[model samples]
Every structure is written in structure tokens, then in C-alpha cells.
Target chain A: MRTEEQANQAVEEYADLVRRLCFMRLKNREDSEDVFQTVFLKYLLYDGTFESAEHEKAWFIRITINSCKDSLRSVFRRRTLPLEVLSEEAAAVPEEHGALLEAVLSLPDHYKDAIYLFYYEGYSAVEIAEILGRKENTVYTWLSRGRALLRRRLGGDCL
Target chain B: MNQLQEALRGVAATQELKEWTRRRLVRERTRRRSAGRKGLAAAVCACLLCLLLGAGGYRFYMSPVSYISIDVNPSLELGLNAFDRVVQTVAYNDGGDEIAARLSLQNMPYQQAVDEVLSDQVFQSYAAQGNGVVFTVVSGDGARLQAGLEGCSGYYASGGHSYLADARCLDEAHTNGLSVGKYRAYLELSEYDPSVTVDDCHHMSMGELQQRLEQCHEGAQSTQGHGHGEHRHGHS
Candidate 1:
């Protein structure tokens, strides 16, 4: 188990990354908060040592993604929130990127993950494959298909 | 920066979320540590209870509740626990010590221990030379003493006599450095002849004690008969 100081450090360092992953995967602010808290609690209880900063960050990413998936699969969570509620949640960000955030959230789950890792987190296709436990070729395919979908959704050569 | 990166950068964790998660983690770590300490305390309590019960059981099993004294020329005694198993052996004389040295009677059943003593080569040789053997069961519990006498009589019915006695005299018997059987015989012989002492009787064999007791009874009877005849003749 991690000491209190170590746990606080981890929460401070990975809060933004875990929050982004949860927001991308769960969409609902309440469910994202739940997964966010769960991911840090898991970090506190995790006993293994990390090889490097990258390894530690990868561990946090994997745990956060899995936690979000678990939250989405919960039987008690409402499957489809009202559009007004989604709009209210989406209003948390700047108004200029509302369309872009909606476009990203509306993408297929695998494409959203591939695109976020590629464009936002700056992870290579091979590194994403290692983090997501996928074949390198499969990740390359997802990246290609994800970019095409994003181009169509945004209606420009934004890529 | 790409538009997607620019857009996603705006979606970051708030300060409230990080502070809330850190507080909850501290609480969870405290709760888990408390539970671990409780589990360890419970394990230690269980071990102590087992040790206490084991020690109590050993004491009960080793405490003697009855005694069986076998006296031929060698006066030896076996102390039995509640289960009728011998838990102690004592020798009262040099002959008794010699016989005790030749047998392993501890933890044997009283009846089996009697059989072993009666069947010993030295005891058999004494019996063969016309010495009388006596088996005495002494206990505060009458039923147990009766049962012990009956059990031992089966082993040496032909050559030995079986008797039951109270355990109250055991301390006095021990004080005089004698087995209960010898002490009992000493009591009877002292009654017949007040001059008899434990030291004198301690060295006497069971056969010699019995012989002296019979002679005392015979002398008392004859003297009473002769006095009655003299009184009747004077009255006539």
C-alpha cells in the first residue's frame, strides 16, 4: 500500500489525466467523478513499484480507463441522460470548444481513445497499443479510421 | 497545438475533485489499518485460549485419585488417576525398591499394573517360598475402591488376598514411611498388642504380620475362656 504522502502526490500528478479519460469514456459528470475517485483509491491501495514516470503514468491511465468502463457497465446508471442535462454538463468547458468536445464525445469509444491518446496525450500508435493491450497494427487501423471520422464530423481539413 | 489538444486541454480536473479524493484515500487507509490490527488481536486471543485449555487438560489427566498397594515381601504402591490408569509408583522398603526398579508400571491400568507386579520373577519367587501376598485398594470413593479390588482379584485370586480400605489413613501411612497396606496391617497388629510400633512392622513381611495377628487373637480367646471357667467354678 502507498503511504499517505505518496498517495497525495499521485492524486496531484494524475488528477488531470484521469479526469480527461473519465470525461471521454463516461461523459456524465457524476459518473466521471465516481470513476475519478475510484482510480485514486486504487492507486492508494496499489502495492507494485513503477519502473519509471512513464510506467507510473501508464498504470494510472489503464486503471482510469478500466474504472470508467466499469462505471458505464453499471446497471444502476442511467444509460442515456437527457440532452439538456448533457448540455448543462458540457457547459462546464469554454463555449468556443463546445462543438469540438461534443464531436469528440460523439465518436466511437475505440476511436475516442485512439484519437485522445494520439492527439491530446501525444502517445504514438505503438505506445498506445502497449497501454491499451492491443496489437500495433490494430492501433494504426483505429488511428486511421478515427481521423477519417473526426474529419467528417468536424467538416474541414482540421487534421 | 492541434485543435483537439486545445479543446481537450480545457477539460481538466477541478481543485475540489483532487482534494476530495485525497481526503477519502486517507480515511480508507486508516480503516484498513484498523481492521488489520483487529485481525491480529483476534489471532493472539485464539492461541492463548488453546494454550489454557491444553494446560488444564494435562493437569486433569495427571492428577491421581486412587491408590492400589501390592504387598508380598516387597511393598509397592500404584497411584491411579480418575481413568483407573496408574500415574505414580512408590516403594516403601528395600525389597519394594528392588521390585519397583524391575517394572515400568507408570500410566498402566491399575489391574494390569497389579498383574505385572504379581507376575514379576522376584514376587513369584517370594510367593513360591510360602509368603502371602495382599492387594489393597484405597480411595475416598467407595465404588472406585470396590471396582479396583474386584479388578485386581482376577489377576492373583489364588495366591493373594484383596481388601478395600479408606484413603483417609494415607497421609498418616506416608508420614511413617510405609505403604497403605503395611500401615493397615500395622494398625491391626497395634490394636492387638499396644507395644507394636510402625518401625517394627515396617520390616515385617505381610505373612509375619498375619501370623502375629492370629497368635494375638488366639491368646486373647484362650485367656477369656480360662477366666470364665474360674468364675463359674467359684460361683458353683
Candidate 2:
């Protein structure tokens, strides 16, 4: 069992990582915050012991992605969020990074997840595959396709 | 990291996000502890309830009662009270209504009630399956009820064309100590393995008998059926 002090430290350390993963997948502040809360609560309740900090980081990344997927598959997401909500989210992002964010979000879910974990979060395709529960080759394919889409949208120079 | 990756990393975890997560985790811990206590209380109550029920059920089960189930064509379950009188008669099928009409079933000893049932032509006509008859005896002393069932039916060669032959097969199986209704399903199967005697099959389980009887040595060996050569045997 984790002590109160340990639990506090975990929230402090992993909150940003979980938040970023959630934001990258969900692409909405409201949904990301909900997933962020869900991910940490699950981590606290998780009974398994970790071998190292890397293992612990992997755990947070995997669970945060799962939380984001769960929110996306939820009835509320299917019923409520659409082009209107997505456009609002696109508008909310900083205008400077607007095209990049739009291009990343416009890619299919798997490609978006792969590209974010690979480029932005500095995860290898092997690590991304482990996090996403896909074959490493599948992750590589997603990354290649995602980069191609990004180049098409933002031009090869920017990519 | 690339320029894009470096810029994205600048989107740091806010103080608000940290504080909110801390508060939520604390609430989750409290709620889990509360749920734990409730679960413990519920488990204790369940154990107590089980103990009480076990004791009460043991007593009711041991009470002196003769449970005579009368099955003619259809089956009728009779629960006899301490006085050996019919207190409850439950019909499992529609044919039981016919047995109820033909037999004066109330207020009789186990044997007497059986005699009363046998006296009815409808009772004689009732073949559980392949003219099989099931008589289960359930007795209790007010703590536990132990039941012994005798299920017997005929392995009719005549495909029920001969009612007497079918009854004889029932008698034959009962004499050999085979469970009547259950083994009736294996009636056609016996033709496959005629070497396995009824006595050999008597104590074997339904599945065992079915499996054993399933082994036909050389396709189907011809045999003298119920009517020919004393197929009817006396119940021991």
C-alpha cells in the first residue's frame, strides 16, 4: 500500500505526463482533465508493484492512453462531440501552432497517438507499441503514415 | 528534441492540475475505505444469515416424513406427514391430473398409497420412458433428508408395439438394479452391446453405462428381445 506522502508525490510527478497524454489523444481541455483525474485515481488503486521508475512511467503512459480511449468511446463522446466541438478545440489552440495541431488531430486516432508519442513525447516505436498495445511494426507503419499526412497538410519543409 | 517537440514540452502541468488531482485522490482513498467497511459489514451479515439458514434447514430436513413420489404415465410427488398421510401431492406433468382422478391418493401409508396407484389402469399404462417406472423414497428424522430412488424402464425390442414386453423390460432393469428413467434413454443402446448384463450395468452411472453400451463389437449383434426367452425378470 502506498502511503499518503507517496501518493502525493506520485500526483505531483506524473500529473503533467498524464495530462499531456490525455490532451494529445482527446484534443479537448474538458475531456483531458476528466481523463487526467481518472488515470491518477486508477494508479492509486492499482495493486501491482513496479520494478523501476521507467516501469512506473510506462504504467502511467499506458493507463493515461487507456483513459483517453475510454472517454472517446463513451456514449457522451459519441452523442455530444463532433465537428462543432472539434473546431472550438482547434480555435482554442495557439494560432502559431494551429496548423500543426489541426494536422495532428485530423489524422486517424492510431496515427495521431503514434505521432504524438514518437515526436513530442520522445518515445520509440517499440515503446509506443508497448504503450498502445500494438505490434511494433504496426506502430512503425502508423508513424510513417502519420508523418506523410502531416507533410501533406503542413508542407514537407515544416515536417 | 525537435523544435516542435521542445515547444510542446513548454505546455507544463499547472498548479491547479496538481491541486485538483491531490484532492480527488484523497477523496478516492476515503471513499474506498468507506466501501471497505461496508463490504466487511455485509460479509459478516451474510455469514450470520448462512449459519441461521443452515441450522433451520437441517432441522426441517430431519423431520420424520415419508416422501413417496408416485409416477404412473406422468409423475406425481407426494409428501407424507409424520402420520404417514398425504400432505402434499405435486404434479410434474399434465398426465399427473389423470392419475389424481383415478387414484384415492390421500391419507395412506407409503405401500398402501402405491397399491392404490397400481390399482388404477392409467397408472399401469404410465411408462416414464420405454415403460419405465420411477419410485423414489425420501425419509427424514427432522435434521437431514436422505433419498433412495429406483428408476426402472424396459428396453423394448418392439419399439413399444408390445406394452407387456416394455413393462417386462422395466421389471428386468429394476431387477438388475439399473436407474429406471435415466437408463431408459440407453434402451436402444443395449442392442449394441448385449454382452454387458443388466447386473453389470446396475450400479454404473448413466454416463458410464451410456459409454459402455455405446461400444458395439461387430455392428449390432442379433438378440432375443423382451418377449422371447425370459426377458422379464423378477425385482429383487
Against the hidden true structure, what lDDT does model 1 obtain?
A: 0.71
- Residue-level lDDT tens digits of model 1 in A1-159: 689999999988999999889878775788889889877877776655677999889777766775665564341223434434544556666778877777776666667788899888999998998777556787899888877866777777664
Residue-pair clashes per prediction, in order, are: 0, 13
How does each model score on TM-score? 0.51, 0.51
Q: In angstroms, what RMSD does candidate 1 have relative to the true structure?
A: 40.5
Tens digit of per-residue lDDT, candidate 2, span A1-159: 355677798988887787666666674678878878876776666555676898778767766765565575342313544434544434445667767766676666668778877887788998877655456787999889888877877887554
Across all candidates, what is each one's fraction of true contacts kept? Answer: 0.39, 0.19
The DockQ for candidate 2, computed on C-alphas, is 0.08
Model 1 spans > 4 angstroms off: A75-80, B46-236
As a whole number from 0 to 100, the lDDT of residue B155 in candidate 1 is 36
lDDT of 2 at B126: 51
Q: Where's the lowest-lDDT run of ten residues in candidate 1 chain B?
A: B227-236
